[model samples]
Target chain A: MRRENTRIFEKETTGSFMNKEFIAINALLTVEQAILYLRENVRDKRNIYYVYIINEHDRLIGALSIRELLSKDSNRLVSEVKVSKIIFFKTDIDQEEAVKVFRDTDLVSIPVVNENGKLIGVVHVEDILDVMQQEATEDFHRMAPVSQKLDGGLIESTIGALYRKRIVWLIILVFINVFSGAGIAHFQDVIEANIALVFFLPLLVDSGGNAGSQSSTLVIRAMATGDIHLKDWFRMFTKEVVLSMAMGFTMALAVSAVGLMRGGVTIAIVVSITMVCIVVVGSLVGMSLPFIFRRLKLDPATASAPLITSICDITGVLIYFGIANKLLNL
Target chain B: MRRENTRIFEKETTGSFMNKEFIAINALLTVEQAILYLRENVRDKRNIYYVYIINEHDRLIGALSIRELLSKDSNRLVSEVKVSKIIFFKTDIDQEEAVKVFRDTDLVSIPVVNENGKLIGVVHVEDILDVMQQEATEDFHRMAPVSQKLDGGLIESTIGALYRKRIVWLIILVFINVFSGAGIAHFQDVIEANIALVFFLPLLVDSGGNAGSQSSTLVIRAMATGDIHLKDWFRMFTKEVVLSMAMGFTMALAVSAVGLMRGGVTIAIVVSITMVCIVVVGSLVGMSLPFIFRRLKLDPATASAPLITSICDITGVLIYFGIANKLLNL
Candidate 1:
């Protein structure tokens, strides 16, 4: 299955799926002659949406749709019948980029060219549809809760295989959580003095984790859709900062009443302030980590939910207790 | 944009994007006559890959490719040339289902018919590709960490609008974490007696949250890709139970060593047992949630990562304390 994963990856080149049987006619041929040639020579005839017009050097100069060919004068040369404004992909380009081209162009078929600008193969729209589906599946898999390994197909994976895939992330999270433990250990005296502080631990930390996850997922998704580029990082970060502030203010107001009921005024103040700080910091960290990854040329999706949570777990504990220690004077 | 969303939704009907300019001819028409009619009447000549043969009642009976029409004897009737086994969709059917049909059959254009089997429209392959991209985007948005409101497009949304979308989930989570607080409160006496127990609280609960998140995501993705169905619930649950047991046992062994160093053998035993139980229960709960949502006709994706984490948090705390109280004589 692992080898199969490699095979799939290798097979993603544009040349691998390109249709070699595509109609390529000499530009000098008449529309009548081109149609006659297509009628005689178009084998592997499924999804033949367009005919490529090639010059004397066999370089693709233009493309003619069946409609355009049929609508034109029968004696017109293929170059006269063809549309010169066409998009083409090199054979070595990734299939994902090819799918993007198909989507952006809204064309039914695109020609695949070699380095010399000669038409080598054609990628049909149906192939692009398959590529789109595969890309979506990969994104979903990559963004999984703990991000299991990409061992061939996801759903059909064996139990042991799936366990092996998921446990790696969990183990990393567990180790990262040791820092969370250390933070708790450092604040033990305060916790011993005010045991009620322990009651709000999960609330404060999990909220931060949730907040961070929301911000990171938004950034990652925006990146995935090409809506947010590296150039937009500053704007994205600024937006997150403002959004988190508004969110934090709202949350502080909402949770302060509960905090008051749980403890005294000092505890309420401690918790409220900690909540605001955690929310703001969580969102900023979430928004920033992806940009850092992108800067390093790593996948931004690698900054996953659990990864964000583990990070926030450690920082969230530090913030809560640091605030409590000062405000409660424990 | 809200109106645009509605328009897109309304446009998902099979008839919405269907091309009415499809070439349909009587079976008695010769290939020459069919081609002549197509040249004269086929207004949308861009993607004319197939020609349909219909009976006198306008019921679609067969289909022929352009290659077949061009290569065949010009004197032959359309019926003699067309393939009889054709797949078609009803006009009112959702476009998602039509996309599925395109994927499964790998057909370029599918005819949309009325209830009486009369051809009404033809759905082009290009439209299906567009639908696939849109559907993928919608799924990603729906399964977001804290799903934003469908105000318009997701990434293009305003900061305030995105904050409004996200805060609902956080506020609800805060309320839910209050249950977690109550769980911790219920076990306050035990925690005060054994402060070591407090150190392991995040570790145990977060492990469960992580495990639960993994299960729910896998199930949700499987459901999205059409790999899992309602009937597979029993099998899916059984698989999860076995997988979680393997996962739990492995995690228990690894963490028990750390537990022994933190506490004593009794505390270690308690934490280890609780870890195993929580892992199993967490995974089972996560696996069950999406199925339950699906059974209720709600989106299975609504059982989101944070929602699963919150659910596991309360239950995980209870389980850890429940086990610790009995074993450590708290």
Candidate 2:
């Protein structure tokens, strides 16, 4: 078996191997060779459709259908009946590009080739679909701000299997939160003096998280769709910064109104001002973090919405309190 | 012009109209005709070397080529000369299923038919790609725990535009925070009685938000990939609950260690128990919200990660303070 494997690999490399394994008999092969292969080696030909044909260089040349073979003289050259022109992928192409090619071709299987144009492997459409599903799952996980791995299972099993995958990031975040917590703790005196300021803490943190999620989602989606690229990072950040400001200003107005309705004018103004600043910071962080991750050659999805929000939670609180202390003298 | 427009609309209803919007001379006329009138048009044509032939009833009967059209007798009947045995898509099929069909067929385009065998639309590979991107983006956003609009601009004229999108959600959260703030403010006496409790508040909230973000990201991702369906909601809930318990218990131990180093046994126990319960609740809420949104026929991606964390933030604080008030007797 080892010797045979070596022989097969050698044959494949030299591009002279003329066996069923090297031939791709089920997709665009010559009619004569396909029939000969079927009669001699293929025990089950019920589902087979087309036989693939390759050249001396291992480049795909054409295809021959089973029906075509049955209609032709058995002795006829396979080349005479084979349909020319085949769709395939170059090996170095991006996976997403491969998916697009598959979608465009609508082929059940496409041949993949190396840089030298030698056929290396076949990428089945089924596999592309699998990749698509996996990618979609990853994007979802990234949005959740969870540490991503391929295997997605039940929470119980996955927690065990993906403990490090999930917790490593969370622990990092936890440590980061310590700084945020410390910042808040450092402002304990302010809280003690103006206890009402503590009333808006959740509101400020929540708002910043929400804003961050929105900006990050748009950026991530844009990147995934080819609607935006890493080169567009600065553009995206600029856009989010403006959009967040307008949104923040409007939100501040609304919060101020709510604050006035609930508390006095002082509380309303403090809450409103803090909200605008927190949101602006959140949007900036959310918009830029994905780009930063991308720049670091990381998956942009890694800077997930939830993770961004968590980060914003720390910053939002710090900003809100800092602004409140300066503005309200708390 | 009005008369022509009326004629066009009438012709469309009767399936007698051929769209003259663009003349693709290289395309198989029959396929092009189907796309011209169909709501969904074929987006690519690089697969299946030859385009299949169809009859007026839209029944697949043969295949033809650009070469044949250019070389064969122009007067030859397309039906008489076209190669037969065409592949296609059954209408009413799932879009994702259609993607699978396209992948398998290796055709540039597939004809879509309804139950009555009438061609309704064409699902182009490009459209599938768009759907894949959109679906992935939505998942990315949902994992973030905040909802975002489906349509938004990626470019910004000024920082204000960027700020506005983020600020809206932040402000909404700020108002929501009022309730949390009120909760914290209402419990001021608790903080005043035990100042150290205030020190742990930020840590507790941050931990809870982090845990919830982690779980929500996983559940949202699983659902996005069609791995976990609505039918699996119970399983998902059960899994999350158990996982959260374990996570909560582990976190309690860790926090307890910190508490012991900082304070005494009473503070350690209080903080530890509060951390465990809050983290567990946060995970449950975070994991469940996306599923709820999906059930409501809303995009689960709209359940942004930040939103979940914010919700967790408020809930985490509530749980912490509520438990602390009861246990510490402030």
Candidate 3:
């Protein structure tokens, strides 16, 4: 249900990932009978871990791992040999959820059931491994916003594909950078009045962006790994705010000396305050954007470092100049 | 061997990850005898897929899946049922290599052997899944330079730990930004004459960092997944140059219009040339830092997004000012 809203996951449900070949034995067969039946039928099925059991209507009944089945009394009925609690997936569960399931149960494969509880197919750990890698890589790309996956390795990918993959985001970021330019432009008077203010521009702004990048990275990965949920946003935000304040003070203490050496006490004050405010604002935006994207049913990694940095650059400019404009009293 | 150089991986070799409990049947047993042995001993053992076959010396000789074993004739010797070639790991192989081996072989668990080929223990698919997630997350943190992972997620991590994790990088970045400050300080006269240059500074510098971030992320993730290697460096660098030039032109085209609107034809030319040059420099630096780190027996992921951006920002400042100073003749 949670995955239905995300477009990338819609098609890869457990129904689509079933192993075509699996042994589904009847519930009536004794261990001895099933072994005899399977010896004739189960030739060369690649790594069969679990053999499913079915009742008269062919509905799912129980399950037995080959390991358990082998270590049982041959005269015991399939009912006596099978596992009591079957862990299974409905046809609609996404591969990500399937990966989570396999992790919990330690079963290499699980049965997938249809609407009427009939076993349609089995999903294996091999597929789960692939999904784990795919989901992680997809999220990696989005966080990097490498934007699209290069199906092959980087060396194997065509130059055009590389160019196309990277250019759009760079261009979009240039557009976003316009606001930073505009923020600087709006404070032309303050900038001209104290040209020394210009010295700390990149230093201060880049710190904000860097802090924001860290915040977004933390929140995005936490969400991706299911370590934190959507309901945890407010708690996360509060933690980020407190975390950023302590970080801002540390950065301010380090940056103030540079500000003082460049432009004296007033300039140091402006840069330090701007540093604190920008770090807080930048970090808050960085941490919050991913949560917003997830709520919109989008990949939270869409709040990439470049995207976060570009945005923080805008806020960084405004905060720096806004602080400078007031303090300089021009 | 690829892992011995990196300190983080040295402790996590397959020797450290071997499962404590596994079934190792002797090569001399008949199928019926082994079954009777297992039936008594294997109750409640979780997800036993492969019962490895060993020789008189306890050396790994072959492996038999329980599924395959059951389908054999009861009177057949274990030699008749066990696979001819076994898939296993040396006790010293790293977990990442273990992960790759599991991916290539469909077995849920692979046995580990000592230098003498004596059976030590088995490694399971469950652990592979954990490593897959952990490796991806570690590289993700390194790329994000989240610096260190918050083991219990963001909400549970202390403000002090969060501050400590994020602050060092931000402080180091502040020092790196000094080059940008010095570059601007060196060009103070040029700015006094043509102050419009300051408006384009954040926008232009960020584009370089953004482009660099993309390039580094590509190389880093590609390396993590084994899609590319250290040997591909020269070829990748050449491709990056070509890729950067094309991207530079595209960005130059986009940024020049704003350049023209703001500061006339002369400023536009300076901005365009600087844009092209900065992207190329940023792209080259980002592409190579990882390779350099790898060669030094460190994590290539140490070439992080924030690190790339800070270095790019420094180069961005110098290049943009050098071009503007020559062209403006101030």
Candidate 4:
């Protein structure tokens, strides 16, 4: 709201926020003349943090701040002082990715280059901040088990729009959850013989779901921030396997205490062993699904909590029942 | 990584990122003297976007940029060209809040003020970007059913650390899920009489959990972004009631079709009616818990997916079996 006057930054395209009237002096211009040119020609100079240097082709050669330029000898050519170490984004780069570059490089402003590497515009750090916030809000929305349309800011959406966005997912999840019912049905005899087995149904499957949800959410967020890559699949998988096993072991020990009280030794052994297996399976499924989605060129966040939970439901049921049948002699 | 040499910015304290070396000129200093002072004293001027103007008492009065000073007449007093419209943060402000201010105001750098409104330092946008990314990662970690320590950057955390962080949540959730088992246990006679009724347990309860997860995730994210404040509770609650009812009706219709094929007309009627009630209950519970947490001065993100799912599972089972008992005259 403080930036009401800076509505240009809110535009979807980066070009709208570009300062076309920027001071891009020829590399040969002396610092004093470059200062004179900036004073005489540049208007709307609210965010002129740096002065760009270009060659005959108007391709960006280097950049220097006004402070840097003023600190140096006014008699020297700008080419003599400008730092050639530059980080820039292409004109067509996503604004979110542009913000990442700025954050990674810690630049006050980044030059925009065309396909020919000709300098066209500059993206100020302030503008990139806005884009980053918007992208973050969108990512949160996408990661929820709701429609993509709700990815827009909640305050900006109408009630009708919110309903429309959320209903589709609930409907799809309802249909998908049918498999969970069928999975339970296939193991009906096991439950019919030992009704106590039914009591652990939500507990067993939910453990898997919870473990899976944790993995997918972490993996998705790390992937988004470029903290993890597709190439790190081996490391990621290995780490998840070891971590989940430890996690599963801890959870099994905790829950087996409860199982010992309620269902005796046979039930305790079945539930404890199943806990370890389900958690490992859940974590592996959750952790790997995002990588698979990325490899398939899909948005990794589409592997949401509910989707992961629903998938875990089937696998969890099969594993829990299979172990119970073998151990409990169902 | 570009800011590796600028190790201070990565600090948890905003004061660390403050540029105490900033050009704070007196109101009467001529633009020439201001520029000369900057040239003589400043070092490591990588992000000197603004020049703070202070009084004799060293209290900040206004700000002027180097570009503004250079473009002005050399003899003009700094105060004559400086703008008093300034935005700033306090030294003790949360880093996430500082990032929000940067995004909202679109400032290249924000001054850090002391208790007496004296400018102590400046927070460059680049530093704010790092804080923002960390906060985003933390939010993702909190929303999951994992431990907070795992919120640390994926690449930086050890496997043992990740396991420790995540195991706490999974173990707690397993204990919480025991109530879902109890809820199912209470309805054992109804299930034994009708084996088909047992089939929809995962479907019915998971639908509730999924719907609840969606609502909680959206509310938590909106709260984090400052889009939905605690003051907006009445409006948020009213909107959620309508939206969830709509979602519930849609899900009920979809699932009842499956129920009819699997369990005949009575089961269809019971499951369909239960679907609507469970969804509405789940959504309302999920939507309001975050508000309640905020009102209690707690982190709204404490209403995590696994926590909500465990809560919903108990209620979802009661609703489904309660409806079946009454409708089927069991």
Candidate 5:
């Protein structure tokens, strides 16, 4: 059905997938009469789960399931038997927002109305399951920062297409990482004085990126699912301060042991202090990127692991060497 | 309702969320009489969408939607009216598998049966939205390699809890990255000869990790969504070879430009060669870990960005230094 669409509703809107074969009964029809009307019209409708009630203007005024109508008085008009408090979507509602409606109302189908409240179509739960899956897949792909939408399966995508999608981010990131190289070059004296500092370079920088990746992934995913919101940043920041400090302290203890074994007390202290500071910095940087993205009206999911890692690498290099320079007096 | 469970269905099985208040009718009864039976009993039932048909032995036989019954012959026996080819789940079926069933069938609800084929309960599509969201969240957290599941919202989790979750992966990764440090230490002779080599180290190594991360994340997400199965690995591997070579060549070009400006033609040639080799190796490592994890019956999602980055960092260090040793001739 989707392949037949010229546009593929890639806007991911409720209107794009709305079923126009919906059967809306006259509000004046009795339960028996509505059954007769539905029996004649709803034979091949995919969204046969419910019969909506529309008034003179064809506005969706109420809705009731056929199962619920079964227990109602047959002579009573559907207007009297229907659930008057209608939960519905406008034609332009985002698929994700529509999904939230389904989650909150527990309704199998919803009427899609125009802004004027006239029923134009219906959205069924059947299509919504696919929508949720597709939305989640997009988030996963975007968080990878792969420009290709994975419209088809990965195996089906051509090598050129895959390369095109992947190279964009890798190129951008590689250039972004030049700053980390510059950061290293800027602190060349510190590195030259104690060449042993290079041993913990990958270990320390990767730790910062790793810690950042964890926070960014959590925050981006939480935002996607509506679990966390923009307003919660202050509270989340406070929470992260304690979390990163604890993480930083534990990481410092662990790395200092490696520091002591490899380069004695001076190197041990430098790496340990760097570890604590960088972890705290990396985590906060990771936790904050999504919020910054959201504020800038970019997708929070694009605060991806690679992007955060590149940014953190620069910071980690500067911090690691700065601490070493002061401690070792290079 | 989930909170009331002494167990929160942490196993995430279908039985954990099934609605036991389902209505079933005697197959011997006429459709008219069955309707009367349902109208009396289904008023308070949560699984009101479908009424199942049970035989004399209480074995599951057929099921029909009340909406479908509205169009059926009133006096027809339910055995004759019902659709006998019923879709159902056994008590122990996983929730993820159940979600697949819903996606495929487009049914609002499905019956759950015991081993002997007695209808014990029903699972509704309403509950499935939450299940998919939860499953997706778990995949997100585990890919972050956070051990603590985001049981409540992230903002709601204690600092201690968040710290514990974030620290486990960070600690493991730091130890795993010891190989990278060891790899650099072993190459001390190569680095001591050309101090300029240290400048491009982070940029080049992170490119490999960044590229590799893209591949691993795509594979892991595709596996989770049933987009690609384990059997497709060879086909995907062939595709990846071409894809990675293209990406490797592009990244080499991008970085060699930096290599040329920073350290003349000789450094450029070494960095460019290292870039191509490391990117290819990293991508393969990233793509292969998920398949290996799946083969071991572990979650492929654990082939997270950070885990793959750490492993690739070790490989990248070795590849970078090994190439520099031969080319620079220290």
Candidate 6:
């Protein structure tokens, strides 16, 4: 049976990629036939990295690199000098996981195997790098909240694809802004009376959004890397609370100083007090929302910087007006 | 010199855990000394995985793993067998980049270095993970447009802090909303005449913001990983365009079907065309903004999902109204 297989192997090599093809040698092949066949027919023997020794059923038993083969006695059978122990990837495994393994092991290439343990293909390190780059790009895009498949293609083609992915979300956010507009218009009397409030309003919202974004980015990134597990919600919440307090106090002192410098006592008090309250609430909300999304088994990234910022925009307005109504007798 | 170092090392490990002072090791010792010290004196070597092999000047020369010692020939000289290949992090390197390397390598610990190659401190992978988790949470909060720090303590103590972070941004966004309101108010005559248009406004803005966020996320993530360099701006922009077109057309078709179901033919045509154009533009803007920020050496993450979304919200409204004004002949 092994002899018959060797005869078939010789016939198949006649049509394959001459420099890249592998020649399977049965353990029974005489040393003379193996050397002659390699020397005469295989013109690119130097390029062939390994000569696999196989069993009668075509199972890989051992391998010999070309250098190893030449170092041995020329008369020795290929199987006599073969080295054991091979690492390979199974076909059923995920490509992403396979890429990770490729990176971790620093293997030049990995052999692919079918479910039955038969050799299928080879995954090169270069290919894994390409995959990693593509996946990282896709993750970044996903974080942005656009959806699209990533693949190798022309720049023009990719841009056209990107445009389609982005537009729908923009429309939704725009319309959402109308609600925010309604929130503002509802407070028209407040704005008219405290026109100074209008001046600080943009600064407040932009800062609040920035702060909230900082929290969400941190949380989402943590969740992505598996550093903070779902079970650590309480611990995370506790940590966020403490961090927010320190941050809020520090920011309030700064903002209050700025307000005092620019807007006098009443405005300073109002801005400082409001600044402290809004930042604390925003930080907690930003940190917790991603956890909530993750608990729901949704993509935590969907609880993104922009979504949180918009939510804060609406909430900040309500809080500002509510606080002002009580404190400033509005 | 080695004998003198060994005599000094023997004098340092003499106390119990409760009474023991943690004396920092300043110089590299032999593998036998490392093993003996760790085995008898160091109670919690779980956190410190390797012994740093340093030169006399405290320059990191190599590392010796405890596990490697356990498996290797125990009688061999430490210098002869210690692994010389060392991967380390410089102190001035950005924490973000450090986190990525930590995640990718999955090392138990990494040595930190200064500009002159002097050893600073060992950044245990666990500590890096802690920092990463905290940062991620903070980013999440900032993304929400909140201004406070959110990770370090109890919620009760931090509530005030949360308020500070959240309120300022909310106030600013509230005022910013006025501009959006003004935009809508400018078109009040148009909206009142076509009340149906008002109903679709929210959906459009939301979709546009979402689309923009998707693009921003992808671009930002690509930037983070060093996959998309500043030089690849043209490629990134072109890809965004292609992706946007494909996504925009698909969404337009879907929205058109919805419009036809709700409104008459004119409304359907207006909404569909507006949807495609707004989404396409939103995606392009979202994709490009991060790269622009990166070019400016500003953090691409600062452009964020919420910032992009909010900006897209305003743009989407303008586009929707502009298209409606022209197409509806209002």
Clashing pairs in 4: none
When 1 and 2 are scored with DockQ, the better candidate is: 1
Which candidate number would show the highest lDDT if scored against the true structure? 5
Fnat of candidates, each listed: 0.54, 0.50, 0.73, 0.75, 0.73, 0.25
Write the residue-wise lDDT of candidate 4 on A89-159 in tens digits: 66566676677778778678887776677787788887777777777777766656777646567866887
- What digit string (tens of lDDT, one per residue) describes model 2 on residues B1-330? 133233322211212221112112212444333222221222222322234455566555555432233234444555556655555555435554554455555443455444555444344444555456555554454443334534554553345443433344555566566667767877888767766676677678877877876776676666654557778777777776777777778778767876776557888888989987887788888878888998999866555555666677778777887887898884
Residues A1-330, model 6: lDDT tens digits: 233223222221211101224556676665555544544545432223345566777676776543344345556766776676867665455554654465445243455544455444445443444455454555455555555654443232444454455555554555455455566556656555554554355445545555666677666766665557788778767777776666656666766755666557877788777776777787778788888998898978887765776776667666665676676664
TM-score of chain B of 6: 0.80
Off by over 4 Å in 1: A1-9, A146-156, B1-11, B19-21, B41-45, B55-59, B116-118, B148-155
- Judged by lDDT against the true structure, how good is candidate 6? 0.58
Expressed as tens digits, the lDDT of each residue in A1-330 for candidate 1 is 133123222368887787665788899999889988988876556778678899999899999777667667778888876889899988788887787777676577889887789777788887877778777876765555555445555456788788887888777777788778878888888889999999999999998988998888777777776777888878787788889999998888888998899887887888899999999999888888988999999989888778888898889999999988887784
Cα miss at A300, model 6 (Å)?
8.1
Q: Which ranges in model 4 have alpha carbons more than 4 Å from their true place? A: A1-21, B1-13, B150-152
Q: Where in model 6 is the C-alpha error above 4 Å? A: A1-330, B1-46, B69-77, B104-106, B113-120, B151-154, B188-193, B261-263
Report the C-alpha lDDT of model 1 over B1-330, residue by residue, as the tens digit.
123223332457886777665778899899889877766765456577778899998889998877667777779888888899989887677877887788777578888777688877788887887778777766665555665435455457888788777898899899999999999989888899888888888888999999998888878877876888999888888888899999899889878988898888988898889989999999999889999999999989898678899999999999999888787784
Model 3's chain A TM-score stands at 0.92
Docking class of 4: medium
Task: In candidate 3, list every pair of residues with a backbone clash.
Answer: none
Task: Please provide TM-scores, in order, for all candidate models, with all chains considered together.
Answer: 0.92, 0.73, 0.94, 0.93, 0.96, 0.54
Which candidate, 3 or 5, would have the higher DockQ against the true structure?
A: 5
Model 3 segments more than 4 A misplaced: A1-10, B1-10
DockQ of each: 0.55, 0.27, 0.68, 0.66, 0.72, 0.13
TM-score (2 decimals) of chain A in model 4? 0.89
Tens digits of per-residue lDDT for model 2 on A225-314?
Answer: 666777887767666666666777787887787678666888788888887888889888888888888889987776665577668878
What is the TM-score of chain A, computed separately for every candidate? 0.91, 0.75, 0.92, 0.89, 0.95, 0.71
iRMSD of all candidate structures: 2.2, 7.1, 1.4, 1.7, 1.3, 11.1
Best by DockQ: 5
